[model samples]
Target: MKEEEILPKLLSCFKETVEINQLIQKEINGKDIFDSYYESDLYKERIYKIQDLDTSIGILIGRLYKTSINLNYYYFDCPSQVYLNHIEEREKIYFDENIEADEKDFLLNEIQYFNNPEVNRSLDFGNFDCYSYGKYIDYEERFKITIRRKLEYLSQRLEKYNLTVDIQEETNIIDDNGNMIGYGTEAIVRTKIDKEIEPIETKSKNQLTANQIILLLQEIGFFIHPKIEDASKVKQAELISLITGLHQKNIKTNIQKLDKSVSENGANYQRDIDKINKILDDLV
Candidate 1:
């Protein structure tokens, strides 16, 4: 299959897995029902089906990674590593005192032996059967959690390509006027810029002081990731270098768009084109 097709296929598989998990949760809502049906053929069949889907997802992820590498594209950390991080976080929560002892034990057991049931059985003299463990656990809830974590890991892997499979509802940002400005972190960044920065008129870009430039960039949400708490403390040369690098990145992105418009659409953007040429001339 083509690279573009893999994302859609992966998303479909995830959707099906989520639907099945929800159905299982609905069917086995109470503890007694979950314990009784945990070992039943129907429940086991669905579990195996989910496992199969997970295998398919893993294969697709590998293919996507290979394709990204071949294309020389940047990607986030490996899905396996993301999943491991999730497990580590859960383990930390399990160690907290607020969690009950029985709950902690169940979580610990699941964390350690989830992928190796045979090891669990061997170590516990065949007395640590998964079905028996279900008596103290909500099997369907655990299954749902596992599936959601898997989705999150896979989504993080695909994020660089802008192909995230959103499993939860997103929060929307509302302005003081009660208008929806945007959603998530992007909206927060936009609102920050709008509220904190007033428009300033400079005769030329070169006339703007280093401190002014730094403040402008900060307001425009440039120093967020690395987080420069005080741009004034940075050396003048270093601040200029940062501004130069940011300018180059912006130029590269906008120039590509300008090129596409001029060449393909034959758009008459001569005035803006001349402004870019003037900027380049000034640099020279």
Candidate 2:
């Protein structure tokens, strides 16, 4: 659903969860904390209680709905209406955490990039193409003859299937040829319409940074595939070098020793996976 529709549902769920938390807190404390103490020792101890209550409310609020994560489109609905149509093979997943507020908004923006319905539909629309062709009968009339043969075949198919068929061919006064939607305006005309695609919003700088990290991770994954022996050695040496703050030459020296221990170390690429991850985390 659109944001206009989603806001109310989210608000309602938040309100309901808040109410439930209020009731639970009231039942446990027999009174509210704000009325008794915000300026005293009681307040310090009560801070923990307030935090507990807030966490409870957040969890309850989250449990009331489902979150759908899509690669190309994001969709969200309550459990009752979670099914959707026309999504590509990328599966929808969910995160159950009550993430921090800033992180949540940032993630929502990223999700909107893929799941925005207008954007998704526009992507599908943009790939539509149309073509038009024509044939002139100046030489041996092979083009015209092929067109007639196809038409005759189509007519026979219509008769065999007992279906109505419309066969219309016009003679061109300029070219003096008989054809269907063939040749130039002097003989025939054919037209096709292409579906236009709308442009998507440019990605945020933060998102671009994260994508870069993911690409690096993918490259590292290739270096440590399970099929290779001592694959774990290179990964381990990289991890050790990360903690030890070793120079590139030093890290390579360590990795070479590990490679010497294992037979399948052909051209293993060097990668700084930690730095890439740090960059991604900073953006998030």
Candidate 3:
């Protein structure tokens, strides 16, 4: 059953249990104070009613416990920590000296919603993402694809300007002892910016950043991923880093970690990774 349904039934059952218990106690007290005077037909009926109520209460209590366990499971399964962290980060944005009282009060109430499961559940409009708001928690696969496609789009753009792209990949054969023996014959795609394109046009009033250039290039008969475009600045940078081959540092300001690292350590090709890391880090 739904949590909303369970809660009200549990409350009604509890209230009835309290009322029935009071009646039973009152009858016992009257019988002790007035001897057999309390043994009327009405008194017998009340006693039977108490027994029936006790049985009903036992059943209700069992259902309550089961329903409670179900609710607890739902609560624990939710991405509460993710939402809490988001709220905490948002609230900390107001820690600066020039914060307004109204803004502070609004944030205070927003944070309280995370503490109340009923409020949070009430706001769950089918999309039960761990975070209460429209915050996304999983975009790793989307990021990877976005970066790869963007690089391909950039490569095509370079070709339009009479530039060539070279991409190469080689796999080293590892023997039983895990020592690199020989290189595979498979051809790897390579990328190289032409020296001729070093001074690309940048004087336009709406000149694109290096990353935006990559994104804009995809607009030529190619569509950019909406998620990537709609993503936060930090996410965009991380996606760019993944595609261009760079180590993505966690977003320190927002306290969100990009747990996946696309960097190659102790690899022969460090130049591209290093160059991309520098370019993206500057923007990040």
Candidate 4:
């Protein structure tokens, strides 16, 4: 229940996670006849069990932290899914003699573009074949790296509070063209830190929950139609609108519009949160 006590539990949970990851890694490597055998019914069952256990542990750890998750990014734009769906449709169109020559050429070019690795990294040249044992291992390895990086970041961040926590949430950073470039991860920390003194004007201000921010952005008005598909941009727009009261077609534009007053208020609010967290850390 206390702040100091939280770290030990987190460390213990992480130890379990590490063990599970190691076990999975070993299975993925396979030995003798077992090499590349993740396709076996037994292996599939074991993999699912490990995944379920990991989810359960993560949930338990979140409860201990008392912090809720905010969706910062979407790592799963799933371009592979899009490419596959389009392939099926394109095939049907290609077979249609009634289709125009120019339209058919356009479809062929689009498919070729999706197939090009230099054009899109997420393209699945294997079609759905990547769902098999050998390919799944590759997928698992990438996922493992992502999880480890997140844990490392959180452990370092919580070290200041003498607590360690691990929670995985994706925040997809996109470029001006709405292409995903990178992402961020976040976790929650709940401590029994005593409430700090409230400044007169800012004291009554409430932080908006993730859902509230979404609704607020929709109410502010959309340029064309709502772009809810890219959550990171939506979040950026929400902050920019709140601070500058101006709307932009894209995230970068909105961020660039932040003025001195908005910047100072954000800094002050963060300082307050940090002060409160440090106080809570000391108390535990």
Model 3, residue pairs in steric clash: 166-190, 166-191, 167-189, 167-190, 167-191, 168-189, 168-190
Model 1 TM: 0.27
Over 1-284, each residue of candidate 2 has an lDDT whose tens digit, in order, gives 54334334444444554565565566457556655444656545555665664554344333333332222222222221222232112222223233443433333333333222122211111224211111101212432333344334333433433422222222211112211221111111111111113222333333322213323544457346555434554454455446443222333333443334223322222232444566658776
> Whole-model lDDT for model 1 versus the true structure?
0.43
| Candidate 2 clash pair list | 73-115, 74-115, 135-183
Identify the superior model by TM-score, candidate 3 or candidate 4: 4
- Ranking of all candidate structures by their TM-score, best first: 1, 4, 3, 2
- Once superposed on the true structure, which residue ranges of model 2 sit more than 4 Å away at CA? 1-39, 65-80, 83-284
Positional deviation of residue 267's Cα in model 4 after best superposition, in angstroms? 27
Local accuracy by lDDT, each model: 0.43, 0.33, 0.39, 0.40
Per-residue lDDT of candidate 1, residues 133-240 (tens digit): 111112233333543465455445444444333332121223344333322111111122332353323234245322233434434565554544344332333554
Query: Highest TM-score: which candidate?
Result: 1
Tell me the TM-score of each prediction against the true structure.
0.27, 0.20, 0.22, 0.26
Question: Number of clashing residue pairs in every model?
Answer: 0, 3, 7, 2
Could you report the Cα RMSD, in angstroms, for every candidate shown? 23.3, 27.8, 24.7, 22.1
How many Å off is the CA of 47 in candidate 2? 3.0
Q: Candidate 4 — which residues are off by over 4 angstroms?
A: 1-13, 30-36, 59-284
TM-score of 2: 0.20
Candidate 1 backbone collisions, by pair:
none
